[model samples]
Target chain A: LEGCAPCGELAQRLAFLAEVDRLKSVLRASLLCDGSRRENSAEHSWHLALYALVMAPHARPAVEIGRVIRMLLIHDLVEIDTGDVPIHAQNGAAHHGTAQLQAEAEAAERIFGLLPAPQGVELRALWAEFEANETPDAVFAKSLDRAQPVMQNIASGGGTWAEYRVTYAQLVERVGLRIERGAPTLWHWLSESAQVYFTARTGG
Target chain B: LEGCAPCGELAQRLAFLAEVDRLKSVLRASLLCDGSRRENSAEHSWHLALYALVMAPHARPAVEIGRVIRMLLIHDLVEIDTGDVPIHAQNGAAHHGTAQLQAEAEAAERIFGLLPAPQGVELRALWAEFEANETPDAVFAKSLDRAQPVMQNIASGGGTWAEYRVTYAQLVERVGLRIERGAPTLWHWLSESAQVYFTARTGG
Candidate 1:
């Protein structure tokens, strides 16, 4: 831990890395695209970041790709402590509980604060931006975040949707609308494809 | 795939995302710190990018961190096609061969080329930069990349190194030098700790 400073920056960074490794254990409700097992927050965040990078052109043409990537990568680090609350479980009144919001905000500070000062500050800001979902970058990142589980559900033949008894109406209202707002083209393709999947599965 | 496009950028980007998901199946020699299973290239790249962001202060202060993170994220993506080559296997004369390098370069092109034009060009440039390892950003990224496996090996009770018959001398020569070159303090700690580990195991 000794490096020219009393509390080494390297030590702080290593602590942060070790702490975030716990994120790999926090399982999400969605399955991996392969359906081998439930996906973890670490892998989910990684996929979202890659999605942001590859799909940068889809995010409002003026969006900063770097900011979107950063937002995607850090969006779920708070879940390292709060754990993932599956969207299907958060219908209407359940989604807006003040207690859940307060806990996640505190978790964000404690988790991101493990890094050295400047790095911690930067990441917390990015996390906050994504939480707000007001910026184009945040909206785009959220779009991918919402779309990914739907893609996994469809890929795995109704993996989460079937397991949770999630209705097509809920999927459309919760996930599809956000995708449309952020990346209209992606929403169009995804919504149509997802509808076909639900229809085939449910005989709607 | 249909949308208003000066080009079909969104479709191309989505295709690239689906293509890169194959990286999740492309396993590497390093085990997760938990020793559950071999880590995939996607998660490894994600960890390295997060490492670069959190540990940037530990790199030579002059390093451009944004570039280092980008390099870390895309560095092993070529493995999506070429497959991972364990470090222990690349000893002395076996390390350098025209065929291996040529195959990887081709793999890089085909994988990165999956993105839309401008993004693909940028990523290809980033992947090439990491391969060259001359820039400060590349060196920092390479340092993290090398150190990660060592940390995992140590954490998992000599996992891959023990499995592959990797000697202390080989680890020092191949990994230690790079760590020393990029982040001397980490090299000092890791080399000392790793020497103790090898000595205990081999009585050398």
Candidate 2:
């Protein structure tokens, strides 16, 4: 709208690029389930983006890989304003769940709106699709994000394990859900790896 | 050029957004000379963006704030492949500098070129302008990015000081270069701050 009709797209492009860059500054995630040892928002997004690429072959019934890629990329932008809340820690958080989710939902809308209308709508839809987890592609993308780090943790002798003292049961529940939801093979391997490592551990 | 003229600037806009998103992931700075903690690329850019905004009044004469802002925003994209080579690390080990700078220059061209030709050209110009540090806008942008974090670290009790083992002497030299190049007033205050802090300890 700020530029000539022909230049409108260029204007929108510049504005959208600026918006996502701004969003990156706001996105943060904790390596631990607790608020400590947090990684910057950009690192989290990068991890997800890489998940989309490497894990693409493992998606469900198969869909547009590009669309699924888009879904994974925007899925976590909402963490910007709501600041990253550790989902696992919310088990007994009382009323914090609804408020936190609502804050994320609102932040998603505002950050997406930073783009011009059309792009804003497209990205918002991708984000929503990923959150709903009903679509095959979204399910796969979400599972990968949840599962890859679990794989890393197991590989690293339980990443964030010593820091947070994550238990076998708790870790299983967190990592096992992915197998049931998407990428059965990755989930299967992850479950087995966790089993072998958890049992072999000596005195904590 | 990938998109036909009729298709317009859509390709460029999408490309630019995608490129900036990737840059954020690649960035990792020690966040001070002392290497206290890592700062996300996005946060670094945000701080620099803020620097451009607040320091406009003190920018070199005839510098365009908009150009400077754009340059500072994307200046670090080159870091995607190069990673954040700290200033202190560069002091005596300048032998490998050309390859890294060349790689970044190419990365900038490829990333910014994703947009429409004109937009790509505009962005590349801005990126190179900041790197050259010859123009007033480039000099001012570079100076601001360097100077702000030094005082910020000092105020924060050498956030990076103890971590990275940065000395006041190094900060003075780095901060002083900015003053000599673009922002004399800011540099002067910082130099004086270093002197005061050092003298108090010296029993002067």
Candidate 3:
């Protein structure tokens, strides 16, 4: 299989597929809205791609939605090696320290490297763009990444927020601003919804 | 949330998202290659999107890979209501009977309709195109749809093929031809791999 001509490329792609299948086991802290079980990174990535597709019209400065969807689909493949670092967890963003960033960069190289050279490079660059979150496409992709869990939390009666004790103000400071930067309209609605949920939960 | 201006559109999109989240609970006959548990439709859709991204170069007639990836992401959202009809199940293709097709059509309308009008119409059309499997894009998307589970079965030591007692010939007739039509290179390698797995399993 290894020495075969064209089949060698197919073998490499299959090897990459087999390795990434482990992503189904990398569970995130967020629960499904139905409260069934924690969601895995694979399904979370899928849902975010759907988010990009359905929510594209709302992205600020507009974007090439195809690029946004692709970014969402591959953005989290690194979690297959590094495991999910829940955003609501204590010092979660801070946890992506220099060491953690270095580990993720290595994981991205190895995982995407399993493809033939052209695709491996293309996808690795897309993943890097997502980590940078600077381009309009990447910014919207990043917004959906943050927006999904907030939707889940509100639907699941404060899902991770309840579990991790994430306060409304903290959520606004941490998650809201990021989503607002890319999709202000979404943050507008989500902030209203989040306020309603928190006010009801605390009877304030 | 329902009747308010502007926010009305956002509400509809969020409704659509919340509804489709049920897709994660729709289990498929295919197992994760790791053999940990059965795969769900959401993750399966995700992996197929990844397949489109990685395998686009092999698509005959070439394809707009973004549209192909989008098709893969939403192709199985209908399974949310119709439930997964496993390809290797006895009379599996036959089981996509008039009744099932009607159910899936209705499911697509009700689900996609939950989005704001433009996105809803656009997506519903894409879903129908994938179902029709006529265009070059549709052909390639459908090919990856079939190829993914075969890859899973082979990697998991004849995963579903062993469980369902599917023969190599049946696999060729049922799955291989569709793959070959859109991706000859992929079918060439998959058929060779499938033959090896079946032959070794039977010691023939």
Candidate 4:
């Protein structure tokens, strides 16, 4: 029971949890496949974790699914502070440029800092790895993070693509290359669907 | 490149992903602590997974944090089929009787079955372990599944407790005991807050 004493560590953990609840309110540009409403960052993270778990076999060099899952779950917590920057919106990457990257790094510090030291450092590392997309696990995680919204857009009949008037070339250049790096199989399957989607849109 | 051929395995995996996207639409009994609206099962699953990550250190016997995270992520996928049955609601457990168990098992089968064989079997086994709540990992996972809503309720100044007219006695018996078994420290701290919350309401 002495160990169970009300402690600052517990309070810090709860504070972090409470702050992240804001993520459920931070909407992404992607729509639900059902076309219900825009998906939020929290559930999108959850879905991407699911993607990692199910799609681990598709990773070229293989990856530790657990590490990939960890990356997916916490990678977007920075969005709670910096808000979502959709990569497809006109100049969305431009918008997620140097200033946004700095803000996201600071947000990661403040948000993960809400936890006790060990846990905060571990999660901060995972976030940084996901951003780097250098390791096999991080690359696979980045693939899922990109793949999910593409699936949603295709399923919802050109969801954000339609709304943003994105072209096939932009979709391939901006999103397809990243997915190809980590998950060529997924990108291959999705590119076929994308080609059909855009071709139909142009009545080609 | 041969492995990147659009194959049946890819289709099956995508089907599973598309089907589970419905999970985001299924709402839960607990409101977001912000009181903006009810949280959906998908986001709740996401949040609980986040909880397992941050609170893994608190589990009494300690548990595999990765296994706990997977359990939390997929535990409520059954709710996509059966919908959420809030425990504090009158007859809630009664509603979760044999028939409901059967329905949930079937839901797990159909949903996880949408993935290729190895992945589906792996995920379905995880879901069953979560339901059994017998393993240390499952017990800690159950602790988080319970702790999250109680935290949400307390944070929102009795979010679900007020909504369901839950009494302290019922809270202690129904929720507190479960959390105590795996996360006694969390229960100790939360019970103190619950005491003050209920005491203030009763003017005791």
Candidate with the greatest lDDT versus the true structure: 3
Highest TM-score model number: 3
Model 3 earns a TM-score of 0.96
Please give the ranking of all candidate structures by DockQ, highest first, separated by commas. Answer: 3, 4, 1, 2
**Superposed model 2: Cα runs more than 4 Å off:** A1-16, A22-37, A92-96, A162-165, A201-204, B1-204
Model 1 deviation from native, Cα RMSD in Å: 3.3
Candidate ranking (TM-score, best to worst): 3, 4, 1, 2
Cα lDDT of model 3 by residue, A94-136, tens digit: 5567988998999999999988998899999999999998998
Expressed as tens digits, the lDDT of each residue in B1-204 for candidate 2 is 223245445434423443454444443534433344556664566556545644555676798865665566667776766677666554525424788788888888777776667757876887888777798898898887776556545444554444555566766665567655787766765576566555654467
Docking class of 4: medium
Per-residue C-alpha lDDT of model 4 across residues A43-82, encoded as one tens digit per residue: 9999999998888778766589998998999989998888
Instruction: Specify the highest-DockQ model's number.
Output: 3
Q: Please provide, for model 1 over A7-89, each residue's C-alpha lDDT reduced to its tens digit, 9 standing for 90 to 100.
A: 47766776677567667777899887777778888777888888877776667987888778777777888887888888877
lDDT per residue as tens, model 1, B1-204: 234243466657766666666677788888887788888787787888888777666789779877787777778878877888877775534444687788889998898787777889999999898888898888889999999888778767788888878888888887889988888887876777677779999876
In model 2, which residue pairs have backbone atoms overlapping below 3 Å? A27-A41, B12-B115, B34-B160, B34-B164
| Native-interface RMSD of candidate 3 | 1.2
Kindly list the per-residue Cα lDDT of model 3 for residues B5-124, writing each as its tens digit.
466777888888888999999999999987878999999999999888888778865588988998889999988889999888874465568998999999999889888888889999
List candidate 1 stretches off by more than 4 Å: A1-7, A90-99, B1-7, B90-96, B202-204
How well does candidate 4 score on lDDT at residue B20? 92
List lDDT for all candidates, in order. 0.79, 0.59, 0.88, 0.87
lDDT for A163 in candidate 2 is 52
Clash count list over all predictions: 0, 4, 0, 0
What is the C-alpha DockQ of each candidate?
A: 0.45, 0.05, 0.77, 0.61
